[model samples]
Target: MRTTTIPVAAAAAILALTLAGCSGGGDDTTGGAGARTPAPPTSAPVTSAAPTPSASSTGGRASAHTEAELTGVFQRIQFRPAEFTTTDAMLDSVYPGLTVSDASCLAPFGVGWDTSDDAGTVVFGTSNDRSMTAVVASTGETAAATDLVEDARSALTRCADGSALFSMQGKPIETTVETAEPSLTGTDEAIGWRVRGTVGGNAFTLVGHTARVGGDVVALVGWDPTSNTTNVPLATQMFVDAL
Candidate 1:
């Protein structure tokens, strides 16, 4: 998909670049699901600043949720937090769905591409190139949510060593993805992964996560220019908690 780099902007902070949760613990990827870490903070979270909602979240959005409902979720995220951006900007300032260089990898990475009657999408961003894309959708008899989460984890794990993920402005990005383990509890199932590489030669890191909260599947993705400061464990914890 047109996996271009997200539009540049700024915010208080972006998503967690570390394996540690917001409590600032450790980045352990080898542990089992039961071996979770601490919880992240709840304020000034991912894509914190209010971003203009996209069409899929508005007229094209599912359920056509009321303004009040939207505001409440926004408030939760603002007070809460993650990081990453794709052009449609969540799944980097990249897309409502991600367009990848290799077509086979599309389904798992393109988190927001599914705009079924059961789903609604919204993207959040700030002034400093920070962003998070969230999608809330219902599961069906076909086990949509379960498949989605599982497939994403599988795809990320397969691509962990590095591959051509997408192209931005014709620049191919060879990304090395590492799965993340968030400490926040309360969800039937969860999946997360972070991407590291350069876009047009500018280093960047992005993280995305999804969980099954009852019948609804919620997903969040974050992106930021890679920096020594971006790997803060506390922010990563804070970012995962909001999910």
Candidate 2:
């Protein structure tokens, strides 16, 4: 894993959504029979939402992207004049090989990197192995904190590594991904699941909590990784509850 320095001004970026946040697998390359594609491990077939569209599908907007989406932007979202903050040790704990060159940035997301620096209102940080990098804002950061919580709920709706997941509201829309009948099920059916992933070659887990946040439907978008594939119930609550 190689490490490198990322500039502050160049590192800051404002994603479409309003808040902050932060998966994994082995290198087994065995294929299934004559096919080169490795057969997915037969983990017990965990049933959650069957993958169906929620009530929000009726021309409704999402409150925000789920945790998975926000986490997906860990390396993609950066804030100018870095404002929010996190410690180096915290980051290292989450991402083993993280290194910070700025020393003036902070990771507003619940997770952090090995090295972090703050520059004015802007924050900067990089993974130890340099596989990921990100920056966030501390200005008006508290206001976005609520948005962050909502994102977390959305994350659960999409994928919870440990606990079972189901929608808490509307029925999950069914969609075909490969040969699997993965349905998006109702929000009432989408809940639970552990959050797990890797950063800088280290394993990390995030679980618990379905925080409520204030933000419009437009405020939350493109925040979770599972958005494209599944709907997040918690996120829907935040969006609908947003004032």
Candidate 3:
């Protein structure tokens, strides 16, 4: 795990594609074996759309070039300067998650505590009201990206259906994890999941994906109470393209 100072200019990006505001209409729970999404803000304006991420042939894997080199990528998703935070300890302040009910889920998707270390760099932010997070850390045991990918895959299996992940915020957000197809492409490996549960007593749906692009393991997440999961694949693609 290594750390790099984020350039001041990189924080001013304004092309937030995926999570500007929560999507509209209904939830789309029509996939399998993907990943998980972030919890929504307790209070947000319903003016922006939620988003996802994708990858490409070259210069896309943040690990191949530098450690935790995802500042620019998050910036592309409209994570304004004030919206960004590099301190891993303050994750709960930005992302809609805390400790999860199923401890196994923490290693991979939910909190990703085992994914990276404090020595590594963590860049998290909220786009408009949509929260997105990226961790550029090693597997800790050997700094191997494949190991982390396997961790996520194993988590999907161990924390099977009915597994509850509590993002204890605003009256406890209890999310149930279900497998989904990989919405992101051109990666060494990818995993996806669709989480449906309650936030503030209202039905909420989250579409999320985790992919190993080259030497980097990137996770994309977004949730809406309305269940509008349209173009989720494209949402992640937008992030992958940014890389």
Candidate 4:
């Protein structure tokens, strides 16, 4: 992993730095083929935009899903399903699946999961950085977190020839949708968007959702939070599976 680290404190209006799905709401870990046991909120805080809007939903899905719900789903996976986690070795092993290349990876902040239930955003992030915000969506879209992954795929379709979507401060990141083979799932004609963003004041590469994973879309995103971009993309991609 590179040693580039972006300070979250310098980011503008960071909504919530807490890991996704570990809210104080009680353990919401759900098991397979059985009723889910609601555990106490795992010390993680839910990041919400200020001036909270009167909950209005766009899609039929309930307003934003709680982090606990997202986490429960991750915990239910056959292996360590977390997109990002406190366990470094576990993160290193699982995150590679989400990557466009081994050279890129998810940055670290606090290893936890997150959900934008109100905005229909479900994310499991490694760190908190302004440039790290990956998805933007309507609350209705979030209800179908899987669909949001499809939406991301659709958006990528717009950028042919390996174009990527980027988020920049005081500017809009340009993107051109493109098609690529998912190196992990061995799916041809898989949908993808190549993403680029500024890190440590320089252009950096980020990629996500190159293939469909068990009816879900996954993306890997990264920045210069650490000089190494090894696992950031894998972490973001893990969020898609966790959703």
Q: What TM-score against the true fold does each predicted structure earn?
A: 0.51, 0.20, 0.57, 0.34
Candidate 4 residue-wise lDDT at 95 = 30
Residue 12 deviation, candidate 2, in Å? 39
lDDT of 4 by residue, 1-243 (tens): 122222222211122322233222222132221123333434233221122122222334334445465444334221122433333332332232222221111221111213323323343423322123232222333234345444455444443233133233334344333344443322212343344444335555554433322222333443334422333333333343333
Residue 117 of model 3, lDDT score: 46
Q: Cα lDDT of model 3 overall?
A: 0.45
Better lDDT candidate (2, 3): 3
CA lDDT, candidate 2, residue 227: 35
Specify the highest-TM-score model's number.
Answer: 3
Question: Cα RMSDs of all predictions?
Answer: 13.6, 20.4, 11.4, 16.5
> Where in model 3 is the C-alpha error above 4 Å?
1-63, 67-69, 80-91, 94-98, 101-103, 107-110, 113-121, 134-143, 163-175, 199-201, 225-228
Indicate the worst ten consecutive residues by lDDT in candidate 2.
Answer: 173-182
lDDT of 2 by residue, 15-69 (tens): 1121222111222122221222233322221112122222232232333434343
Cα-based lDDT for every prediction: 0.42, 0.26, 0.45, 0.32
Model 4 clashing-pair count = 52
What C-alpha lDDT, on a 0 to 100 scale, does residue 165 get in candidate 4?
A: 30
